[model samples]
Target chain A: MTSDRFDLGGGEPIITLRDIAKSYWRETLEIPVLQGIDLEIPAGAYIALMGPSGSGKTTLLNLIAGIDRPTGGSLEVCGHELNGLDDDQLASWRNLHVGFIFQNYNLVPVLNAFENVELPLLITGASRGERRDRVEQALALVNLEDKMKNYPRQLSGGQEQRVAIARAIVTDPDLLVADEPTGALDAKNAEEVLGLMERLNAEFGKTIVMVTHDPKAAHHAKHQIHLEKGVLDKAVEVNR
Target chain B: MRWLALIWKSLMRSKRRTLLIVGSLVLSVFTVAVLQSLLTTLNAVTNNPNSSNRLVVRHKSGLTQMLPRSYEAYLRQQPEIETVCALQWFGGYYQDPRNFFANFASDETTLFQIFREEFGASGISEAQIKEYLRDGAGCIVGESLARKNGWKVGDVVPLTGTIFPINPRLTIRLIFKSPKPSDENALHFHYKVLEEGVPYMKGLSGSFWVRAHRPEDIPRLIERVDRHYANSAYETLTETENAFNLAFVKMLGNIGAIIQGITAAVVVAILIVTGNTMATAIRERTTEIAVFRAMGFSAGRVLVLLLSEGVLLVGVGGFLGVLLVNLAAGGVRSSLGMAMPFFADFAILPDTILACLAGALAIGLLATFVPAYAATRRPITEGLKAVG
Candidate 1:
């Protein structure tokens, strides 16, 4: 544990983990999901987590996204320690500092692409004008400005994923967490979505943590961390 | 606002299911409306104080017992009793047994005076009334029955008696149109004619109708009349006409209770069916609800969406039912044929519609409790995992 205090002198690490572990109870048997993990990522860092199935890559991404709490660990994101926060506080914190992109492109089926992308701004107390401007800018970054009014079902797989990416950066959060962002797409669509993520990282300086097992998807990130058996194996820095 | 749009889209997703639920609500509310109208009309006819002015004096034992015809003269002697007439229920039928109508034999002289508002020939002169009174075998029939039987003035009408035991043939000298159409149709003739025609009914009258000096003094006058005949050979039981009419309705037992029970059952059944439909709707929209919650909608916002859908369905249904009931009021009154009065007054329409809306809102709240809680309680991680 890091004394339960933010090290503001070090300019606040975007994410900090110390001995993080998570377990599930299945019929009275303890199923350890993540065991004794320690890591840190600074602001404006694009990090990719790669691992085989059942290797806790998605679990780690969830912890970083503030959507799940670790059973035993000291975890901090955006200068807030998340160990003692209640569910509502965590939700509020996620709304303010985190944006997520799911592999399935979890856009609300009923709303148009612009509305889905603008959702994160609703909880931030932003004015309507500010929300509209930011949502439009984000959509234009993903080259989806023309398809803003189209629903998720009307868009192609590549377009839906691009809308999801636009949603992730619309809030201008300090951290973006995407789990298997390209897992459900064909090769052509996946490459298009990867190109959009790379553009978001380079053009906007967004600190992103993407979990994917595909090497081609990992190549879009500046750094990749592999996980094996609930432990971080190694890290590799990739060039554009 | 965003959440509301989402809910509207989700409700529109299955048009057939939504229509089915709404149709069921319409049917339930329609039935409730019609039943309430029937009860209201029956209550109005039986309890309207303005229409009931004829006091009924029967035997102290019961209506089955008869009073001597001589008591009619004795009753007329009292200054408070303005005019006296006797009526014996001649449970008679016309061409078909199902063509039921009220038949009574009364003194023609006072029949017109006592029931002046209910019975009067629209165009006939007083001389005709005097002539009809002079002729012992002359009769007066209601316009409805006259039209049904195709009997006009001066036409002979034949009626078979079930209680008096003889078929009576009389000439209708006058056709009385009801001054108030809401009043029951009655067939009236001379008591002397009936007595002369049937030898066993020589000195007997079933009940007496007395006109009081003041309507408010009816209760005191009834006590006075009963006291005067307290020890007579055939004791008299006197009551206001409204009370007398209500006694027949009361014979069916607590009608109000029966109606309340039936209405309650109908409401409960509707609630259950509607609740089931709403529960299924919420269950099927679990993923969408999660999407809303993740989009920064509060738990209360989701609840409002569900409740709004319910109100829309039930409120529209209730309004349609009210319109249908109002449209059918005249047909129901004519079909009931003197059994029920025309009940056009829907004073409780607003409250009934509100009750239906409240019932729907309650169903919405109850059905969505589990799903709303589940969605709000879900980890965003799990909710996002629901994709694909």
Candidate 2:
């Protein structure tokens, strides 16, 4: 691991960040979001990113997910040097290795549950029969097989999140990056969604990186990484 | 191909908006189709294949000025001329002015011979032609006119003259059918009837219809006949029947340019309307587009999906517009056929239909490309931040 990196003491590292810096520009003004960040996340580890508003947690998450690029630094994910890939290459790389879950459960309103979950496989050139079998399996894993034909508006918040989870994992991606997975859910639904994520990590051996503000939600992760003012502050292992 | 469903669903996301765009496209396409078909029908009158060997000898001033009947003898003297027949526009209506149609007075013996194509073996029988020639008060009407007025052989038809002062009661000796519907809406009678009815009309004819023995001989005959009577009191403007028919079309005053201008305006309007609609739709789906991009869809792929949706929408509308116009063609022909004989055979040609469809699709691609490409080019993070 790099000198400033956190060695999580899990399996081999699947994501490595070194001297990562990101900044946004509002015309002539340049505002820094993340600065001097070094981190290594081991394979199959569930890590939670906890920070206050505008703490750059989401920006860091975006960089690691290959959806955003750092102004200065080298980043690697799933054995691919993300810093070296162009925008299209990064997109293809993401399709192969990363899954994203947004806080708002950004499901395409026109597509039903089945089609939503089947979206990733479409770009992969999967056959119709293969797509059907895999979509059914993913929906079943989320316990939403019965609601396959329901549109996003027809489902409750928790069910919608589950459907989003099904879409995230349908391609068997190497990493799942979620932003406030339980932000919009009630206590019972949030608990149910956290339990599902826990099952995905412990049972399916999926590596997950999640960002949340709620302490209870963070406790569900195997480890908690905190950021303050765009800098990594500390890393702590959960007792559970 | 798999993306087609997603594209279709996205179009249906806002059903009302999609329907409104389609409705606008239909109106635009319909207007263009009708205008284009009018131009095509008008062009057909000037390009009638059967009139290739025929020529008209009208007064140099205009159709209103009468030509001397002696011009037929001079026209027949040319070796190129196979038949020469004196014709005058009777300008008469049957029973009432509202029941108007084309009625011409012509030389009886040479009338059928000059327009053999219209009264050939496929049209009136030989016996019917002979019977009509034997009767001075006999008149021959097209089958469509006979059908309209419910007249058959032996019916005494009375026409009230409009330009002339002679009202002649004539017996229908024969009914003939021509290939062109416009040709099938005219009535022809013996010019002698007009001469005997009005003494002042004795030696004057509206024009002489001349048939050349060979198609190649017509151009030379036109030049010869016009040069023969140039600068005379009754100077002649001799032209092929096609050019003669075009003279009437020219009365409409730059109709082709007018139709083309209207078509261009409609096309531009449709492009603006469709483009604005597509931009609005893309704006509303900014987040959804960002979601697709984040799911690993390339910018190019997303653009293609949006473009497909646009093309499909306009394509459906264009097809319906073409279909609606085609179905209404018969009614339009019959209605306009009564007022203008040229529109009796008006139709939407296959080439025009294809051209309209192609134009609609091109508009679709152009209108959607700018907005869709812009949507795809936007930063994924910015798009993600957008609510709708």
Candidate 3:
């Protein structure tokens, strides 16, 4: 439960966006997904993004994670301007500083829990011993140390989500970006993943940004921001 | 290095698909290896590196027509021609048609002198050569031919003739070894047995073999020997031993073109099968590919991993297939001898094996290129929406 990792320092903006806009093309017509998204999230802050479908909450999450680039505005995550980085540089930036958790668990079907969690570390060129130690530590954090050898197909929905969470946090990323992390899980499993993610933010002082439709899932974060049709709603602070 | 494990695991995700692709690749490469090695073995017949100093004088029209045995007398008078021997093809069978091999009727006294480099320089003793000439009915058999049948030295070999109307039962006077395997599958008997037994072959031969004093003098001697009989009743066609062997291969029809066509078809088949397999595998893993990209694995890295999977699959399969061909060399040689008498030992050459492996790897790389690139270039947000 204790994080003896590098301190990202207090009150510094981990993610900064200025009038960010993302648009795509449907053949000849221009379709806009996100528009004028100006926001700042402080270091070590836990936030949830809430919106209906096509509200561009996941798009904004992707922009912040450096998985997608803004077409019209400045995006800075963990001190690097994501819009200015090339595809390869954006990948390295994401690998080093941004962690991701998906609704489908996204654990490589062939890899067991330990190997899946060790993926981002491999991108950092970490030695095998270092990777093993870090993987063990991360699995233990998620309470899945006993299931480290189980593949995704062999695990339950809850165990798979927890393993995905372990994978997202194993690299000690500066920002954890999760899109509906517990969307596929049952009620009990959803509560457990939310609790683990909350503990990661509160006890380890890790920064997290999650997108969810469930109000209960949003409440686990310290702050909740809503989007309506590519526009932001007022941010709400939650007293947990 | 770390991605190796990932690549391997990804390939094994659908074991049946991977195995099918590998099986197809192995079979294709094995066929290609066999065909190319057969071509190589045939070429090895004409490319006798040790017999460059020898020349053969045959009928100008083709090997079917006979040359005058008097040509051997004229060829022996030349200073450049160290020794000359008349050789006639004795197409015959042993106990069964399946036991077919090369049996030549040649000058018993001078055959040893003309083929001194192939025999005398090896380990054939003076006594064996003298004994072969001492008996007109004696024949010198190649060691392999003798070993294949139970025809040891002093054993009488009864041959049923097919080309000439004479059944010559001759004693095995010597069993000589040659540096070349093709040369070790022939038997040579005294020319007198062939001449006296047949009416038309009294003063005719299939060809006149002349060993030059030096290899460098062969070109001039070839010109001299041909010009000597430029306008005779049966004109002479003189050439090096390599050309003579190549003429026989050429008569067997377009083997080179056939081999090339077969290899080309094999390459195409492998590419199509492997490409389809890779495309399907990548299509099944769209979301996983996006996940890797989102985890900071670059597009290039994704392609490299996928390409490695394909290449390694074919590489491993192709190598095993080639190894199987190598193991079946003995059987292939025995089977091919009935149709292609020049197949020698029928084993795959080192260069041909390397080519098959390289070809398999090339197929692997090409087969996955489009699929891997397409997967890596898929939009991340769109890809994340994929169900599985």
Relative to the unseen true structure, what is the C-alpha lDDT of residue B312 in candidate 2, on a scale of 0 to 100? 97
* All candidates in order of lDDT, best leading: 2, 3, 1
lDDT of 3 by residue, A108-202 (tens): 98999999999888879899999999999999999999999999999999999999999998999888999998889899999999999999998
Model 1 chain B weakest lDDT span, ten residues long? B339-348
DockQ-based CAPRI category assigned to the predicted complex of candidate 2: medium
| Interface RMSD for candidate 1 relative to the native interface | 2.8
Candidate lDDT values, in order: 0.75, 0.91, 0.87
lDDT of 2 at A46: 93
The stretch of ten residues in a row with the least summed lDDT in candidate 2 chain B is B117-126
**Compared with the real two-chain complex, what DockQ does model 2 have?**
0.65
lDDT of the structure predicted as candidate 2: 0.91
Q: Return the TM-score for candidate 3, rounded to 2 decimals.
A: 0.94
The C-alpha TM-scores of every prediction are: 0.76, 0.95, 0.94
lDDT (tens digit, per residue) of candidate 1 on B184-205: 3567888887788788789988
Q: Which sections of candidate 1 miss by over 4 Å?
A: A1-12, A26-29, A83-86, A114-139, A145-149, B1-3, B40-55, B59-70, B73-181, B184-206, B209-237, B240-243, B250-257, B329-331, B337-349, B386-388
